[model samples]
Target: MSSKDYYPMETKGSPKSYSPHKNGNLMDKSSSEQTEKFLPVIEPGLDSLNKNPEDVDFIPVDHTPPDRYRLVFFIMVVHGIGILMPWNMLINAKQYFEEYKLGKNETEVVELKGKFMFYLGIFSQVPNFVMSGINTFCQCGGQASPRRIIISISIMIVVFITTVILAMVDSSDWSVEFFWITMMTAVILNMATGVYQNSTFGLAAILPMKYTNAIVLGTNFSGVFIAVINIICIISAPDPRTQAIYYFVCAIAVLLIAFDAYFLLPLTKFYQHHRAMVRRQQNTSGPSRSFQETCALFGQVLKKIWVQALCVWFIFFVTLTIFPGIWSNVTKKDFPIENKYWTAIFCFLSFNVFAFLGNIVSEWKKIPGPRFVWIPVLLRGLFIPFFLFCRFEVENKVRTFPILIDNDYVYIVGGVLLAFTSGYYSSLTMMYGPKLVEPEVAGIAGMIMAFCLVMGITTGVNFSLAVASMAIQ
Candidate 1:
């Protein structure tokens, strides 16, 4: 038979002859079987870009990057510095307030501090809630364009700087109303920071998962630096007024961070570009889901995973907020070391150092062992109860060993455990939560966790006050 008249096999059988022009095109007898072989395998939707094997346009994803992981490190550092100043300032604020008032004794001092912090927690959340709402909208709407993101971040930084300056300027003539206003401003600024943080995390979620570790490590180190700088401020300040001055100096550090962000944002476009590219590749080759669909997927993920993250956040803030207040008051009241401020400062710095080390170990080990993180956290939880027990030993005013040494040891031990657990928990939570969530929703997941943290702080302070009041009665 002529080649033009030869028909393709529909089954693996003898060839038949058919006229291409008159009897329609020649059918492949074997081709139907071949087609049947692949009939059960469905091609993913166009949005997913899972091309058929016959398609020639399909290209394997390019995972190789031109730049090294240096950008990851740089971004992480920027993130860390941004958070460090705020956290340290908040932690040290109690000491400054106490010095200003000339308060004596743990009971009197801690009560006042606890009340102030409780109010601060409630007041400060206003900005955070606003920021979170805005962030939730932006992430869901798929409006996270670079221009929009950068502008949002810049506004947040400006708010932070402006609020800090206002607080500093008004410090000399501070009143309760002014204090409330300052706290409100600080909270909004912090909320703005949270917005930027969520945006960044959303951007990260779409990229390869390895960069998450870098972010986690960077945040931990930022906490460390904040602690170290706070210690220096405590050591150098001779009086409450001077301590306020040091805080202003730390504000300068924040100003520097703002400047860094300004300059670095443009230069870091490559990193951003790389992330976008990878995300697109994943979206194209992996699965098909619309923006709305992705958001819905993320919501489900949040509902499932947030419970554990919330628990972690609650435990963290309880120990973090309450104990620091108690430790500062107790140290200042009973242990009048020649430089108690320095002792406090060093203890905080040492705590950060231990936290930094913990992060390094976590990064180096790269193990998914839950115990690696949980054991340290559990130990810290245990340490909290221990500290509560020892509160009486210090309260009795007994000279067991030297007063300063005893106080120092207690603070150091507690601080170290707290720092270690905080670093470990943050790392593990970020790492594990994503595994169980849709990548698109990781930003909101983080936001929810942040919300839990603030809530925890609020509850912990309230609990502390209630306990203190009960003890007095």
Candidate 2:
């Protein structure tokens, strides 16, 4: 509901300053002094808000029709995929990068590449972290925030243009100048990636928890699809150059599909209905969050669900640090998989599929609520060192760690547990966090969650790069 629900609000201020249609258009507004009026701040608790079940425009997940549910799920997953596809390309194309782009020898290339790529990846996360961190303030309201939708579509345009440029470029002719230019393009692509990713999470926050889950699931799905493509291209292509070309072509195609899905999402009946209901509800009250008030709202949200907030950060941090960052470097030359970072792709696939499965399993089972959520999630830290040691790394100048768990099966098992816990627990936290307060503040909770999620990911990338840069050699 819009601030109108709190309508007939007896504010002490003389003027107010919020006006925007749900479609993301700007409306003429009075002077900013209107916000100076004394409005009662929001208190915690659904009872405090004086809102009823029917008052909320969107259907509750349990009551929603199966068809609409599926549609929401599909859009979330597709957008999720698009948001992280750039990361996927960077991770899976390690072989191409290691061979053509990096150091002279296998040892130097593998060790240094992980650190370099992680550094680059984290640079991209800055925008995602910054934009999502203050999403509630940036958004006008849950329904009428046209800025988020416009930002989402605009980023798509930039990313799409970048993809086309990449596809048309012939890297074989690249020099030092051209290579750095390519890197600059990557930076822009990743920066745009962060903007949309956070926008999506913010958008989903305004919807039900299931839609959020769907978007998170889409990220892992993107990873799996990218891994599969990596495997197929490696097997089918004549050389690394061909594989690189295939990667670019397929990236453009996948991005196009993701954009189409996002474009169609608003046209669906369920989306329109939900939006209209939110708009209608707000007619009773005008949007009234000011800069200071927005900050206070964020603080309120953080205080309520800090546990879930921390867990979400740790989950991604651990997962992000280990899987490809360290995995890309460690290779047993004598091992059966006689390829560079092939094991990394395998590990990537394993984690994505298992994580997706865990998200699905959450439909029926949610063990150890907030009480024990932190414990198991904390234990996941072991995965970083475990997955690290499992790979072939230099023990010293002359020798390497014994390849004890060289079998693919062992990595597969590790991936399953890691991913399952990551997906299930993370989903549970997000699904429950928003419900802790009034529905009006749910979007704020979601924005915070997205911030924490990206923060964890950004930190994880840093840890992987910093630590592995020292140890991998």
Candidate 3:
């Protein structure tokens, strides 16, 4: 009954324990089961012997199912487009909102034109930031799910439909009221967008890194898609109401496609397999954590990815601060193009096209990894001044600062650089985010990165107000 009685210490390394049939003794040959029973239990990592599978410090063989025909990738991209369609549509329809909708009367036009872009930025991104943070917490608690994505998309659809209806009614008589109504819609649409965006990021995080980048690609592409449409509208010269209708219709169509694509995800073996893996890990890790526990997990994940997360935030912060708020209003200076197309081409079209290209480039290769990614991202702050001094046509506000970069080509180049870096680094940071943490909490990391993204935009937009004021005063 002694510890060494069954197997003496000398037998620990004995060949008999491994193969009693050694030396070809047929009578002494041990059966496979007998040999297996005597074989020593190899403890790879004694500390992990009692720990959960997820707690083990090792990468499991990736048994993830192949994304058939890249269906899952396309779905994430569609969700990306869907989540941003409302905002992009509204932003691209700058003329409609500023000129026709809010510019009905000269007084209202004067009062609103200078302030509308800032208002739009504030209304849209503030709610987006708040909701994304709240949604991230919900994700930690397991309350955020695909169902929330469905509900969020549905709410956005309804909001777009309402916008379309309002577009037809001609609220020119009530421009001020219409302005407030439009801002209200922006708030509502983006609230849903926050949840939708955060959930989509979390969902995509469950898959490969490229899948999450697909969402970033789709977001940038959404802008490109709308910008192309806007260009066409400008050339074709559609009436404001008709053009507004066209923009919302395209947005709704994209949303519908994304909504349809979402259902297909669960049916796919690839998606189901990933979902199962996550669920299994969660179960094996013991029941879901309490609120405090979830918060602790969130902090842990944030600590792991805070650098990349902040990179994601600052990237957007720099982008939003100068983009439509400052860039959209920029003109060709003393070398005016004799048409109103300069801002559209040099600003909207250029930024979107190059940004989309940047996303594609990021997908092709990640430069500098996560640690040094913040370097290029931080250097992007120079773009704020580059755009600030560009020719802006803010009504009634005189430029207090001299135009440092007077040439249109330099300005265009800056726009392209700023936009491309935004897309490229945004993609890099986001893709780096979930990967920086443990696999079980990758989804939470994705949500946190998403919140950081919104936080950046919110901060950038608010900061833009001061920047704009300083530029004009």
Pairs of residues clashing in candidate 1: 8-28, 8-29, 9-28, 9-29, 9-30, 10-28, 10-29, 10-30, 11-29
Judging by TM-score, tell me the better candidate of 1 and 3.
3
Candidate 1 Cα errors over 4 Å, as ranges: 1-61, 66-69, 101-114, 125-130, 141-174, 207-210, 234-239, 252-274, 277-295, 303-311, 321-323, 332-336, 366-380, 392-411, 437-473
Report how far residue 237 has shifted in candidate 3, in Å: 3.8
lDDT per residue, candidate 3, 3-90, as tens digits? Answer: 3343222423232211112353211212233111111121122122434433332222235457889988888888888877988898
TM-score for each model: 0.67, 0.77, 0.85
Best by lDDT: 3
Q: What TM-score number comes out for model 1?
A: 0.67
Task: Please give, for residues 307-416, the per-residue lDDT of candidate 2 as tens digits.
Answer: 88899999989987876666655554354665644565556677777887888887678777776788888888988867666664532322234445676567657767
Ranking 1 against 2 by lDDT, winner: 2
Ranking by TM-score: 3, 2, 1
lDDT of 2 at 389: 61
Q: Give me the candidate number with maximum TM-score.
A: 3
lDDT of 1: 0.49
